[model samples]
Target: MKIEGKNVFITGAAQGLGEGISEALLERGARVCIADINTEKGEQTVKRFQEKYGQEKAIFLKVDVTKADEFESVFKDAVSRFGQIDIMMNNAGIMDESRWELMISLNVMTLVRGTNLAIEHMDKLKGGKGGLIVNTASVAGFGPGFWFPVYGGTKHAVIGFTTSWAVRTHDTNIIKLFILYQFQCSKHQTLIEMQYKFCTGI
Candidate 1:
């Protein structure tokens, strides 16, 4: 699993943890597709990456991850641009208790959709090269969060869904699946450490 020359598709990559992961990937010579709902920020991020990593190292695709069709299209467009995606990172999520339903859609449903799309596109059995699928979860998923009950529940769902897929896909050991438990810390530091551990099998 060399990072150089690999193509990565990442959601919520316009800012925060996703953006940090994208930066680390690009630094390691991987081409990235930064998918996010924020068109302005996403494009801006891409521009910065392109300037630093070369004009073809990264691209931004505006995407509403909750929309299955739009999300799927992002994958297609990314593949069309990069030839293939070697890594899929489902990092789009929200922590709004006032909008719990949208939280579920973004944190849980969209993650599942993204994982499925990754499998469909990268599974060796499906006439494609195998790749890694990484889903971001919170520490709240492992326990109760009274302050943000619904947000915690969505994180719980993320953990459950990702672990279930890992178990189900054990027999077919081509495509790798992982869940990244995000902890409270400096965003870039934590994500860079976690991404290093996972990508390098350290």
Candidate 2:
């Protein structure tokens, strides 16, 4: 898509893939909202982006993806700042099995809620311009891993939700759904089975 002049809201923009993606989009002339729970890192990221790009090109909001109100606020604030949102990236996630519920809320529930909010703001039927929604998943969503099964399950739910929405919104050009799967060796068990075993005391 032509990103120039478009506005994007990304969850988990404090670090990792979300941060990288936000940087790339900003570099391509897109305004971005850096939304993440880490206030310091999120502000740092937005400051860096604004300095590197321009003051109007980036903003940061402290958002906890697991909280519906906070997550919804990101969208509202982004629209208020940028006039409209062209893209919504539901990219926040976690890999801690010890806290499986938090992981699920972070990975799956956030994406679901973000998607709903994105559609509400970007739907043509709702008197807004059309937009794109991208959900970040992991390779584990489509395959198996001996370690981090719960994390994998959360990603799987993401894939399912995105696909179901894809089908439901098939004929509509108002919004598009995409599932972005990142493949990193560190996330896969094959590259760290021994380390996993050592860490888990297995």
Candidate 3:
């Protein structure tokens, strides 16, 4: 499906892969909200996109994904700015395996909260248009990480939640669900799955 004219809200969009996705989407004519805890980097991302894609194409929000209120506010702000949200990318994550609690909090709990908020805002039965919710999962989600059990578990939870939720809500016809697995495997594997399930209108 075409991404043109879509309004995308991406968490952890200040740098790294999130930033790259934002740039790609903007190039495809989608307006993006770059949300992250790093205000400096987030603003810089917005500035870079604005310079390349025009000032109206991007906005930045200082968001702490661990906070439900802040997470929800990003959605509200994006809607207020762009009229509606067409895509929600729950992409914020951390890799510190030593602090298991911190890892679970950021990787697992925060995603659960974000998914809840996204459903509330995007559910067609709730007086809103449907949208696509693309979650970021990793290869570790599907296999064991002998080196980092805690980190692996979080990603495993992500895949579990995303798949189960997708099946549970399958008949709703209100939102399209997708789990974009990070290509940590060989380059050949990357060509095998795009996992881009376009959100058909509700």
Among all candidates shown, the one with the greatest lDDT:
1
Q: What lDDT score goes with residue 94 in model 2?
A: 80
User: For candidate 3, lDDT tens digit of each residue in 93-191?
Assistant: 888877889889888898888787777777777776777777777878888888889889999999889888887665544454544555464433442
Superposed model 1: Cα runs more than 4 Å off = 171-183, 186-202
Clashes of each: 0, 0, 0
Q: Please give the RMSD to the true structure for each candidate, in Å.
A: 1.9, 7.7, 3.8
Q: Give the range of the ten consecutive residues with the poorest summed lDDT in model 1.
A: 170-179
What would you estimate as the lDDT of candidate 2?
0.77
- Decoy 1 TM-score against native: 0.91
In model 3, how large is the Cα lDDT of residue 153?
Answer: 90
Q: Tens-digit lDDT track for model 1 on 1-202?
A: 7889989999998987788778888888899999999999999999999999999999999999989888898789999999998898899998889998999899889998998898888776678787778888878988898899998898888888887788766544445445465556676678777667655771
Sort the predicted structures by TM-score, highest score first.
1, 2, 3
- Model 2 steric clash total: 0
**lDDT head-to-head 1 vs 3, winner:** 1
Top-scoring candidate (TM-score): 1
TM-scores, all models, native as reference:
0.91, 0.87, 0.87
